[model samples]
Target: MRIDKLHTIDSTNSYLKRISKEEDAQEDIVVWALEQTAGRGQMGTTWSAESGKNLTFSVFRKVKRITISEQFYALMAASLAVKDVLSKLLIKNVRVKWPNDILTDNDKICGILIESVIKRGKLDAMILGVGLNVNQTEWKDTPRATSIKSRTGIHFELEEILSMLLKQFHHYVDLLLKGQFETIKNDYEQHLFKKDKPATFIASDGTQFVGIIKGVSETGKLILLQEDEVVNEYDLKEIQLLY
Candidate 1:
């Protein structure tokens, strides 16, 4: 694992993508920064890393001989990596929100963005961007955001956090490569949000319904058991999770 550390960048994920075209960077190339001015999240949401108070980094990994259905494995691996790191920091009640959000005590602590570029009927590469709130004690004017420092009143070195994350990420990637999908899937489900509780889901058609989150499908589609008679599976944009 080779890391390219930067003082500041607009977005580590975009930076890696730009350089990936010019140079053939190998798998496990990490790009990290102390600040991200234009950080991005899932569904084109803006991720704001408050200068030196958070962890903003991206990892590029090359994929071969795997179908797109297996891409969720990579996402699960990355989310688990963040979870492992936070667990080591003794962050209590850390859990993964389906698809890719890390939560602690039901508040969001980290966000993950996984982008895949497919060329020639195979996966060319994947950019995994992770943003975690570490030392930010207070979030100014944000709805439902919390940091490790806010929760624990302890500050952590950004470099030390990144190292721990990368170590766990590499280990999980190795597990994926070895075809340990069942193990990863089980662990992911164990940490999933609203695992056995009824929650509201808003569909693309603007209909709201209460359902139990069964788990995600192999292709990363969210599965919901609705009304004890209807089973619905949804893609990313098709459904939104609600309280």
Candidate 2:
């Protein structure tokens, strides 16, 4: 339950991992920054956040019994945690965009990046990085972005949001520890964006296709049903959901 608050940082995940290499970093320790000069996102994208206007932090959790193959479940738990808190906050149409982004009403409000440390051919620990827009009013030219303040018309206390977010994290983590994989996956799919609906996608080869999101595999690949009854499973970067 210890949080290391920094006024500014290059990246919370990098800081925690660097310190873990230097010292024995405690499990459940959170590295949060009021501002990040270089925040990270999924697919190696740079996360942009206004100073003191969003939740930019990373949480360290030591893996116990979770197998290496089910590692994506850890990410699923974390994404659901963010969705749960946003749902309780009255954020309408909150959805867990596949792989890791949090979207509401087709606008992304949060992004996550989970980095794991492997040791002895097994998963050791994971650093869950989260960036959520809180009070930022404008996103420059990022039209797909939105914030809590923009959506709710109310400013929020970042620490309070962090506390509630952690609570949800623990709640979902407990379920994960108890081996409720199907339950977690089902809950995640229930909040999935565009689940079972016709959607357009961009493939890595610069090809566009239409498909239905059939849900995700146990290993976290996107299950897509395309034309002529073709079922395709895609890992990250294989396909991108287009608005």
Candidate 3:
């Protein structure tokens, strides 16, 4: 694993993507920025963090043997890694809010954005961008946002947390590489927020409805058990889970 610390960057994910194409980038290349001028979350959402007060970074991983059909494992691996780290830190109720948000006690503490490089209809590599709230306690507009310090009431060293998270990443991604599909999938679902409980959802058409998150589809779509015993799959752009 190679880590490059940047005092400042526009976006660590963007920077790593450019460098991976321009040069020969290896797996586990991490670019951590102290400040991201323009960080992003899933689906073009802006990720705002107080400068130097959180964890904002991206890690590059080279894909092998994992086909496009199995790419959802990447998300599972990364999300599980974050949950693992938070659990180690004694964060209560650590759960993965599907697709990529990490939550504790129904409050968001981290967000992940994954970008992949595909060639010839096969998975090649991916950049996992993570924004984790750390010591920052002040939040404006985003009421559900929380941090490690806020939950634990104890300050943490950013580097120590980063190291622990990266180690978990290595372990989980290795499991994915080793073709432990069922194991990873089961672990991810077990940590899913509201796995069986009824929840409210808003469709892209602005229609609000109720559904139960059963699990995730193989292609990463959300599986919802809806009205009249109906089972449906919705992509990221199709539906939003109302927290």
Identify the candidate with maximal TM-score: 2
- Model-by-model lDDT, in order? 0.87, 0.92, 0.91
Cα lDDT tens digits for candidate 2, 1-243: 789999999999999899876776656789999999999988889999999999999998888578889999999999999998998889999998998999999899999999987878898888899999999989886779999999999999999999999999999889989999999999989988999999999999999999999899999999999999999999997999998
TM-score of each: 0.96, 0.98, 0.97
Preferred candidate (TM-score higher): 1 or 2: 2
Off by over 4 Å in 1: none
The TM-score between candidate 2 and the true structure equals 0.98
Q: How does candidate 3 score on lDDT? A: 0.91
lDDT of 3 by residue, 32-149 (tens): 9999999988888889999888999999989867888898888899999999899889999999998899999889999999898887787889899999999999989998999999
Ranking by lDDT: 2, 3, 1
Model 2 has how many clashing residue pairs? 0
In model 1, which residue pairs have backbone atoms overlapping below 3 Å? none
